[model samples]
Target chain A: MRRIVTLLLALVCLAACTKSAGSDALVVGTEAAFPPFESVATDGSLEGFDIDLMRAFGAHINREVTFSSRDFSALIPDLQAGRIDAIASGMSRTKERAHVVLFSRPYARVATGVLVSTQRVADAAGLEALEGDDVVIAVQRKTTGEEKAETRFPNAQIRVYDREVDAAAEVAAGRAHALVYDMVSIVNLHAQHPETTRIIDTELGIELYAVALPLGSELAPALDAFLAAETRPGGKVDELLAKWLGDAERFRATEE
Target chain B: MTAQRERLVRGAVVMAIIAALAIVISLAPGEIRWALAWERRDLFLTGLGLTVVISSGAVGIGLILGVIAALFRVSRSVALDQIGRTYVEVVRGTPFLVQLYLWYWCIAQALQLHGLFGPREAAIVGAIGLGVFGGAYIAEVVRGAIESIDRGQWEAARSLGLSHAQALRHVVLPQCARRLLPPLTGEAVSIVKESSLLSIIGVAEITYHAKNLQAREYETWAAFICLAALYLVVTLPLTLLTRRMERRLAGEEALPVARL
Candidate 1:
């Protein structure tokens, strides 16, 4: 009788294990190369403002949140193919991207900034100085920075790297005249190459950072509700902002 | 070319073209849509043009480096041979992508740091990286071809009052040409394929544009399929040339006098 009971329990457990996954878990895809928002820590695990915030949301909603690292460009396509649940990378909610994917309410604000060699810090007072034909502006491919460079500096040559760090390296090494990227990345670049590179004070335009979800996703409302609550004063978003970025007041975009 | 062989080559080329097209059409996500990408054909064309330029530049520099390194490898001096061996071993042992980063960032940065050379265009740096990477394998290929020439040929030339350099230049080196052609053409095709790596460093090659198109258009499969087709178009001639050289060499082997 005991043996029969053990056999029946084993069969039930096997059947439960073989059940289909019905969205109890959220697989968040992120490009960890973007510091502050998301990046790989020394322990070879993902840790950043976005990673923590996603985890917090998972805790609140009573679901398991898993993280996957991907190239910045591959995140959206992966989401569309049902390979990932949400994109928590430092992706801007631009009109072009919004057309294809649903974006959560703005969680963070970013603006375009130029990073130049230390010698050209004063000369490159604004984007106008970088509009010359001889100027070579470095940008990460398929980013808003590339679009801005193309529209803002028609005469200036544009060089696109796979990673923003490479473009920053180009500017730091003096191979390229300037790097046009997100203000946070520009600040990070200046921090990394303090002696060789500096960030321009002028911000091009305000851009919003948000969590991207697949079109018509059931999780959109829950994500937006979470973001709405967290973005308030003394909320989780403020805590994250203070923790990741110290006194980045000037770089913040005025929410419209 | 023999009539039958030419016909065979032609048939193979047509079939390859058809197969390439079929693969692109079949692999497209959902309904086949070419107009979305075709409307932006200029992007692909520009990328193809840049790829050609980079590959040509890299091949030019690689040939020069390969020749110099091959001479060191084949040299009778121990120091020269050691230098050649070290370069080939070091370069061949490492990954091409890492070498490219070293070239673009570390080495190039050092040059700029010391004021030895000013900022260079990424394309120029990328071409040099590809050249340096290709030079190692090319050096080995060239060295092998030169060594394959019989020891008696060198002895005969030296016996006829020719200096060591003259014997190598006039007799052994010239005879190595037949053996070198097929392999050299093979290397050229590889260089073309390897040029795709330059996209990482911002050379704006075909692969770069393809990636951009994919990300922007969200036609991931279409973008890469077009990229594949473009690469095939570029490498097809070199592949054919390699085959032709191998065939010609095989036919010529039956007649010893014709080999010369």
Candidate 2:
């Protein structure tokens, strides 16, 4: 018991010590699994669209960039608690999120799509077509995909999986007719599982993905300036997105 | 010269294992991480609590349950015999984690059950899960020890006009105690290891806290490996104590032969 008390007190001291993170380095938060936006690449380096952009943005600001990778869900809470300076996870800058954190100008446009077996993608254009009271839709627990599934297909039975990869697998196995996820995730899914499944057309909940600084960050204005420089008047950011997420449309049009 | 040779061989074996592990941890690419290094102390403390709570809870309750269950096994009635067999078989048949999940998510999640039970959710689940699982194996060990008591001694005690309860309290129970300690010590070690499953239900036990550190810092390997080392530290002493008891009991047996 004395040891537990001592450990608790030590944690309190460590929490106190984290108040100052310094200006020389920027601590960037991201879920390294979300590809095109962020993921650990095949070569074992952290590589993705957001990663390249963040590195460039860090260079522009003359700050050394270091990333803390975690499950996507942890990114927002970490950002809100001031644990990281910014989030580069392909987090859609929702109006609801605007209340919690300041966003850089939209550096990447995002949209949602479905990863379904080719057969199911043939049958449905939207959630309503998928909801047959008996039909199952697999979605990641506590994600926007889950929320939309709940909102749109109220009658559809939902088996909540903890990760997007599992949800896509359910679709590929024909256990679930469809899966809801962001466009980047669907692209990655089809790329990985082209023989079994494919992504479908008609995006849902379209929004802008941005770099989020904490609520009332002194860094937001400067982040906005750099985002505009790269994306505002058509510079290298657009060209890079074209090369990376462009083949995504071909996957979206998958048949048979 | 004989002792020195044993010591030299032991030292070489230990040093070789350590050198191999050092190479693996160093050369494993992104697997080598320092992020969870900060919470190493916190992980140690939580693991200690986790070990003690499960070990003591399992051992303490296992003793009481073991006695009751063992009594049923020894009973003359067929119903009690069947009941004891069923309990032992059921508990022994399942894994500790499946039992833990059933207790934590199913039984503990029922709001009325939680409200009626005095202890907090995690504690109740951990206690019940560890207690029931430990009790099963303990029941068999206890039954074996109790039955091993010489039937002639029991007959002699009864011939002296002592009640069955008195025979148990004075003679049978004492004999059972020495036999039980060695196995009981092993059960305690298993209880400590089994407590790792409690982490899955968010108990803030050792593995749970280590996971929090790993997730926050992205140091999966270091956090878990160090946490495993902490568990070894706690359980190794208990394990040695148990082994010593076995040695002591072995010495007691040699005493009988010497007297003969």
Candidate 3:
């Protein structure tokens, strides 16, 4: 117990010291499991649409950007507590969230999609068709998908996972009837496991994605201006969208 | 220091520490509200019920596997001894989280049994994973307890015309029971704590519910504190019971062995 207490005290001191020392660097928290937005590459480096955009914004402001990978649910609490200056994960901006954090202008629009086993693609065509007591739906924790599953399929068995990939894997394994997650991630999972999983035709409503900062943060105006300037045609946002998502009709249809 | 003074000092120190902690929590921030978690008590209660069920299932499985493995280790046959040792070593060597995934996703899928599996099947697999992982340590504990008995007891029973199996039932196992109690209780408590790892596989236990609540409500500290408290509610009684048993057994240790 004494040794554990000593170790904890040392850790607290270290955290305090490092936090004070890195005031100049902007710390951004992200959950890197969502593909096309934020994900770790095979080579152990962070690379994705959100990552590139955050780095571009950091360059615009002339501050060094440091990315910290955390659980999806932890991003907001970390930002509120000042552990991270901003959140750039593929998080949808909602009214409930806007009450707690300052959201910059919407950067992109994405829709929730459903994934099912290839064999069930013909039968389970939409979310409504799978609403039953026996149907098992897999959703990533803290995502809009979980919210939708709770409200839509009130009787379905909902299994929550930390990552979309795991939920998709459940669909691929035939353990779960469907996976409710962002269309981009669902597309990514279908590409990776083409033989086992297929996309459902029904698309959930489009949601605006934005960067979240602590309430009344000084960084809000600058972030908004940066987003406004870079989201136009042939700007950094367009280039990132082209580079990461390409001109796929399914993706373009989700664009606002 | 006098004994009375020592007790008073200890009591004062504990109260002071608790007071300091309370002050720290109170000073944190307006957003850190504990009441937000209290409203979702139903989620936590259901999760705790599942946690108890999983732990009980694991304990039942572990006790059965442990005894069998212990017997194999103490047996004279080389093949049985090798199988016992290999089972213990392999289970103990791997991380429990990886083992859980291998059991739920890989092994269950390969058997073609998980296609229709849901929460119920997931809970059963979680229990089996925890039990298989814990059986190794329980095997060692039971083996050591059995070995602690004097070999002369077996010889005396045999000379008295008792069969090998009868000698074990009449002479060895009674003494082994007392020695096994403490370690077995400890193993059971450890299994209860280890059941938290089942949350990753989607068993809706206390930690799983806590994570969901934390994610949805963003009450990280409140959600986790409630989880820790629920675990303590289950584990503290077991720990206290073991301590009482150990005390009673310690007194019995002073008495002479019962006459054969």
Candidate 4:
């Protein structure tokens, strides 16, 4: 009799596991490498600028949010694998990416800049002049810098690294000529390198970071509606942007 | 001279095209953020602690549990023998993660075990998951090591007027332990690496740290590569130790001594 009861329970559980999961809790996927965007703190709490912003965005969408952290490059693959419903990393919506995944309207737009060493800036007039045979530029893998470099300095030697921090670190260590990244990270990185790298006015391209969804997801329309409603002047998104961006300035800007 | 110059120019242009393509394929905008995180010391320490503590604790507990089951099967008792067989077979048939998930997430929570443990109860869940999963393989190791002891050795110990307990403690156990060490160490290494899976329940081991770094840095590949290297750094010592022990055990006599 006891054996019979146990067998029946096991059968029920095996059946239950295969059922489609509903999105009661928003299963937001993120690659938590970007500080001030999404990062796991010392206390095991996920905190950052994007996290704060996402919390506000979730409220605007009338959804309770939860996060699954994965490798940054795996976000798109994870989303396609049905492991996550949406991606909230600092993903730039580009023409190539649009073919693979649907992106929401931009919540935050970051400017692009080139950070060169203090020593290099004294001699260099412009990027075109710096394109000598010895010039090597560092940038992150699978990001807009690769595309921008193609468009801007096709002949310039580009060195690719696994992450932005490493590439930027290379520049500070005098390993690369300069690093290309968004203005926010460039400004933040300067704190460590102490003006060893400086920004150049020579433009590459501007990318708008947006929330991404699996292509043809039913949830996309609903999220788009929320973004559209919130982006209106003095609406909830503006307030959230102010609050999150303001909060980040206090906590995120300091490492020590 | 003109032809050679033309060829040199064409060769230089080809190399430049290759370099340009390489930049596009490999370089991106966000690699530094993840790389810096991979180099962070605090996260590495946290992950190291969780991996060792969970794996060692699980293996220690599993050793005790597996021995008890293995002995029960060898003992001339019907009910205990059935229990051992059932446990070994069932454990072998199921995947470890499934068992772990069931133990920590579904069954324990349903039993309201979190209140019985503490507020941040995932650690207990992870340890217990480790214990249960570790026990399955440990049972097989115990049975094999014990059974490998010669029948003559058992009889010889008995003929010398030694108590059954004394024979096991003094004679059989030392040999079995020495023989089991390699598998046991392998199991330990496995436990440490496998603890990465417990991050699903929020253990914050190295893999979790890597993922967190990847999410923020958006440099997923480097973080994961660093994580892989970290795990190797942790396990490679055990690998060498196991190799040394295996060599020590290689040139011995039959049954309990060593063979294939």
Question: For this target, which candidate reaches the highest lDDT against the unseen true structure?
Answer: 3
**Per-residue alpha-carbon lDDT of model 4 for B1-260, expressed as tens digits?**
69999999999998999799658646644334544653666777778777887777687668777888877776668998899888888877897778876876567667665334432345566776777777777888988898898887878888999877678767777778888989988888888877888765555677777766654444555676678878988899999999998988885543363332
Q: What is the DockQ of candidate 2?
A: 0.04
TM-score of 4: 0.56
- TM-scores for the candidates: 0.51, 0.54, 0.53, 0.56
Better of 2 and 4 by DockQ: 4
TM-score of chain A of 3: 0.88
**DockQ of predicted candidate 3:** 0.02
Interface RMSD of each: 22.8, 13.0, 20.1, 10.2
Candidate 4 on A47-77: residue-level lDDT in tens? 7656766677678778888887655665775
Clashing pairs in 2: none
Per residue, candidate 1 scores C-alpha lDDT tens digits across B44-161 of 7877999998898788778777878999988898999999999899989999888977886667555542122111235667888898888888899999999998898988899999
**Tens digit of per-residue lDDT, candidate 3, span B167-212:** 8778988889987888899999999999998876556688876765
Write down the C-alpha DockQ for each prediction. Answer: 0.02, 0.04, 0.02, 0.10
Q: In model 1, where do residues sit more than 4 Å from their true spots?
A: A1-252, B1-28, B113-120, B258-260
lDDT of 3 by residue, A70-188 (tens): 66776786566455789999888888899999988878778888888865545546666678788889998888899988887899899999766567767877889888888877877
lDDT of 1 by residue, A78-168 (tens): 5675557899987889899989899988888887888888665455476677888988889987788999889888999999987776677
Question: Which residue pairs does candidate 1 place in steric collision?
Answer: none
Q: After superposition, how far is residue B80 of candidate 3 from its true place, in Å?
A: 1.1
- In model 3, which runs have C-alpha deviations exceeding 4 angstroms? A1-108, A111-256, B1-13, B27-30, B115-117
